[model samples]
Every structure is written in C-alpha cells, then in structure tokens.
Target: MLTEARLVAVVVTSAMAGAAPPGVDDDAFLAAMAEDTYELVAGLDSVTPVLVTSMPGMEEIVWPGTPVVEIPDLSGAALVRAAFAALPYGEQAVLLSGDAPDLPALLIGKLFRALGRARLAVCPAADGGAVAIAAHLPFPDWAEVGFDDHDPVGALRASAPAPRTVATGPGWHRLRVPGDIARLDPGLEGWDGTRALLSG
Candidate 1:
C-alpha cells in the first residue's frame, strides 16, 4: 500500500478561454469560479490544491494561501498533459475543472480513498465529462484522453484501465453554459466564492 503519500490537486482551469459561460460577466465569473474551485480543493486537509491556469495574472486573484502554476496557452489534452507533467510524481494527483464550483469535499476525500484501491479514480460529470479525476502518480497517457472532445470522460475511461468510480451527487456539475446556472444550489455552503456570484 502507498505510504507517506504526496497528494497534488491540479485544478485545470482558465480565465481566458473556457472561463466565461453565458449569463455572467466573463472575467468576473472566471475569477469567482477559480476562487470557488480553490476553496473546495483546499478544504481537503491532506491535499495540496494548486491552481493550474493558462490565464495570465492569475496570482493576483487566486485565493490567498493557494499555490499557482502557469501552463502554456493550450487546451484539451495538451493542457492536461502539460499540467500533469509539471507536477512532481506523487502518490495521487487530482485533476479538476474550475467550473465545478460546488464539488463536494466528501467526494474529493473519497477520490483519495478510492485511489488507494485503484490506479485511477474518476467522478463523472452529468454532461458525460468528468467533474474531477484522481490518478496514481506517473499518470496515464495524456494524449489518449481527449480533454474537450465530444466525450472527454469516455475517452479517459477508455484510455485508463479499470478506474475506480466514486458516487457523486448531481450537484457535481460543470458551469459551462447558461442553462447550468439553474443547477447551482441556492443554499450552497462552503464554496462561498462562487455561490455568492451564481446564486445572487
């Protein structure tokens, strides 16, 4: 079994590209979403969440106490690859999207637990993509797992062998479109950064 584990959370997000969804100011929304993502990941006591962004000037906005890592202005698998490759090898590294404002902390803990049993752990997004994914270090083929393709999670599932899946509530969704705003829980707690913007 793994011991003295190194857990790194690579929050794969952007403030320039897929940052803006409908019904919100692009820049403001992206910043809020990034903050939400940061709060959610950092809450996991044992995990170190790093803001991996292609957005310039991210340091000025990401929540205090969170680390920021900059990647090339790329998207899809290329972006994922660069972010993952940059992280030093660890026992587990979780890949998440900034759009998942209200991702449950319990689910994130579960991902770490699940990693103990499998080489890969994934939580499927309602839209056939993945809201969060955890992989044993020295992760799998980044090229094979298409990031923004028609079916990102499916491509990832196909590429990784027998990944352990954790059950996450419907709240585990991505805020990518205008309709997605309706899915946000008005009473959401913890992720105050995004909740304040989306709920109001």
Candidate 2:
C-alpha cells in the first residue's frame, strides 16, 4: 500500500546521553532500537523508513544505512517541528517511538489505511498514552498541544481541530517506566529485541 502511495516511516531516536531510560545504558537502548527497527522494516512489504535521531555519539550503535538526523532535544514543540521538517515532503509520514517494542508491522499498514479517511490515526499506548501517530498531511502543529505531558493522545484530540481521528484496539504498550516494560504479553517473551527491555 505504501509503495503506491507516498509514505515515509520516521523513527525518532534520542541523543546518546538521553537515549535510554534514566538508569539504562544509552548504547544498549540504541542497539535495541536499531534491531527492533530493522525487524519492523523487514516485516513490512511497503513503506520507506527513515531513522531520525538526536545529535551524534550514537552513530556506532544503530544499523548501517539508517539515516540519523540530529535534533536538539526530545521535549518541547521545537523537537516535533524539527523532526517533521527534516522529513521529505509529499509523503505521509508515520512517526514511531524508538522504544515501542511491540509496534506491529501489520498495524502500521492498518494505520495508513485508516489515514485515508481520518486526518489522524493513532495507536494508543496501554498506559493511556499514544504510541504511534500516522498523518497523511504535513506535520501538524504540536505546540498548540502540550506534548511534554504523559497523555499526548488527549492533547492531540483536544488541541487539533482535525475532522476525524481513529485509534487501534487497545493492546499496544510503550516501554516508558520499568513497570511498563513488565506489562508486555508473554508471547513477546522470545523476541529478545522486545523481551530484553520489556521482560523485567
């Protein structure tokens, strides 16, 4: 579906220092994300992915051929704008968090399919947050909505005057806090890419 349509998969990563959790090692997280991203791309028959990350020092950790676009920081609206601005125009971009290990490739396709009808399509996190957002149009103004807080979904819904929005059925989980990792399903136990971090 993505091959015929203009689409780009934007994977946003953090700088070396801010790459991982507060206590986890940055290199490990980068490596894990790189692996997971490769798996994500391999699983998809369509969609071209571009890996956009914050500043250097992590180049040695990610997969080869992954484009690394450095940004200032992850907080605030500037980061969102910078990330989107870096993307090539005319293609719908699907923004995926580097840490969302459970991101299903099938769902990614589903998101694009939904985007045909809805201005915005999101996969809500298990923690009442958003794990992914796919947009057919150019990036939306996230500044109008507060992204620093935990619940970006609610913010997007309230702030954006989008004509329509859709979400996938509940099940997706993001690995934010340590406890959040443990909430993953047992089937993912064997996928070390997801298990190492999610399975406490």
Candidate 3:
C-alpha cells in the first residue's frame, strides 16, 4: 500500500561478492556500478534515487546530495527483506542489484511504469539472475523468493499469490563475471562511470 504515486529507485549497493570485470578490483567495480546506477535514475523527475546497503563506510562513496539507507548485513534473503522493510511506506520502489552497472534508464523507467498496474515487476538478467525487482512499499512477503537461485524469474513468479499480478520487464545484462562486461554497450547514454573505469 503506497501513500502516493512517488517512485523510489532503491539501488542495492552491496559490496561485490564474486568475480569482477577485467582491470577492476571489487571496490572500483562496485563504485563504478553504483555511480552508473545512481546517475541513470537521478535525472528522472518522477523518481527519487537512494543507495541502500549494509556495507560500512558507504556514505564516503555516495554522491554528496544522495540519500542512503543502511540495513544490517542480514546475509541472503533476509538482507533484501530488510532493505525493502526499511523503506518509507509512501514510496513505491524498485530494488536494483548494484552489479548491473550498465543497466539503462529506460528500463528503470519501465519498471516504475509497470508498477502502476502489476503488484510486482522483475527484470530478468540476460545471464542467470534478475537485475531488478519492483513493487509498492511494504513489499509483499515474497522477498525471500527465488533469490537463492541462479535463475530467479520462475521462482519469483511462482512464489506470488494468485491475487497478486507479477509482470516481467525487459531482460538486461549484469556484470556478474568478467565476461559480462563485454555485454556493456559503448553507445549507451548511462554507465559513463563504469565506462571510464573499464577503459582506464
């Protein structure tokens, strides 16, 4: 239940947990991704971008004017459940994986738009996992669903109650392994920070 139509982009800034792309360490990779994701949504008039994380010292890396929400490093399904639980009831929100550094603004916009109708909308990653999950504030009890799986879209859909409608958005690439970096488009409007780091 949302207080209004306000859209909030909750970028999950969890530290990079696995392998990073070439020439980029975990910190550099995570920072680049964070910057890319934040900038892509920051320009959106209808959306408010906030960095959500359990990582310590996150404020130091955050953009000066941006807001941050700190949650316990609950580890696993509980972490995301807490992230959404920590959100204000008034904000209709989308939870994005920080690893999808080059995810486009258009897709981010589409998720918010889809939330206008469906109770839940998820953008599946071209690889295995999902890059984004969107829903109204006080997110449904499905936070733990499909999260542990390599391919979560099916589990995410199956876990929803019949009363709630789940929508699937366009699939995108997430930089999970070094190879995923190749999927980043040089012509894309966003991800400049990631591009710079990769090119360096």
Candidate 4:
C-alpha cells in the first residue's frame, strides 16, 4: 500500500508544438493520459494527484479542476527532468507517460508496493523505453540518458545510482507510433479511455 503522505505525481507531457501524427489527435492523447492517471489513482491505496505538463493549451483539454503545472521550453530528457523537479517534495511520485493507453492500474499499485522495498521500480515498454517509473529521488541527470537508442533500461541502469532496482514484469507499452497501439492486450477493451482512442 502507498503511504498516506506520499503524493502520486502524474506526469502528462504533451507534444503541442509538433504536428499531430498521422492517425493520432493531440486532444485524444491528452484525454487518454488523464484517464490513465485517474485509473491508477482509483486503484491505489492512497494518492494525491499532481498533473505536470509542458503544453499550455492542454488546460482546456484536461479534466475540470485538475491541478496542473506547466513547464516551458522542455523536450525529451529535459522535459522529464523538469517534470520531476516541479513535483512537491516529501511525497513519493510516480512518473508515467501521458500516451500510454494500456497502463494497468494494478501494475501501478504493484510498482508502489515494490518501491517500499526498492529504491527504484520501472514498467518497461516492449520498445525498450519505460512506460512508467517510481522513484524516491528525482533523477535530474536523466537528460543524458539516451532514449533514442531504445535502451532506457540500460541507460537508467548505468546512470541511476546503484540501488535496489526492480522491473514490474512486461505488460507496459508506450504509444509513440500508430503500430504501437495495436499491440495492446484485449483487456484494454474494458477501459473507456482506451476504447475511445482505439475507436478513433
């Protein structure tokens, strides 16, 4: 179970400046992220929601009354770094991608439960990057970690301080391209958020 004082920071990064990919809409992606965050929070024992994003235009798209913090001129590693830096201290935060339509709430709970024993925990994506990460310390140097090589696990292993690092199995995947969405398990059919995006 997650500690009561810990905050569940949901990092919702957006690519507002770039043109929407061939089949993906920016609004749908943002909605999916919000839904994923909601699911994780609902299934968890105790959590405080903190939505972090770089898209200034997303305030209109996100859920009403959702507390949001905006970051400026950030992308890739810098974006992740800024998001972590913005989170309030003294609360354990879980960083999850805004584009993961199939993020399992159970898996998120498992990650937090594992964090009680380990220093860091991750849900690895099929494409080699991580869909989610739960850590006690903010990794500001993660900017140098090579995400382009599709070796986030390796990058994190080498860069992250030598502590108890654990992986929460292999069900998590990120939605970077259209093909990535098709690989999700059928269990996602029950998710209103997932159905809305896949139906598009």
User: Which candidate has the highest TM-score of all?
Assistant: 3
TM-score of each: 0.80, 0.74, 0.85, 0.76
The 10-residue segment with the lowest total lDDT in model 3: 1-10
**Winning model by lDDT:** 3
lDDT of 4 by residue, 39-101 (tens): 556455666666677655656544575557777746666666677778766456677766665
Q: Which residue pairs collide in model 1, if any?
A: none
Please identify which of the two predictions, 1 or 4, would achieve the higher TM-score against the true structure. 1
lDDT of each: 0.64, 0.57, 0.69, 0.60
Per-residue CA lDDT of model 2 for 1-200, tens digit only, reads 44535444444455322435556676676567555754565456666656667735645544576455666666545655666677654467666666665566666777777777766667676656556667765676642322233665566667667535644433476666555556655664223664575334
User: After superposing candidate 1, which stretches have Cα over 4 Å from the reference?
Assistant: 1-4, 8-12, 15-23, 63-65, 147-153, 161-171
lDDT score, candidate 1, position 49 = 66
Q: 1-200 in candidate 3: lDDT tens per residue? A: 33235555444545453536655688767777776776776676766667787766666655686668887766455766777777654557887877776677788778877888888778888756677878776788764543334656566667777534688789897776677778888887778878887788
RMSD in angstroms, all models? 3.5, 3.8, 2.8, 3.6
**Which is the winner by TM-score between candidate 2 and candidate 4?**
4
Model 3 residue 113 CA deviation (Å) reads: 2.1
lDDT comparison, 1 vs 4, better candidate: 1
- For residue 170, model 1's alpha carbon misses the true position, in angstroms, by 8.5
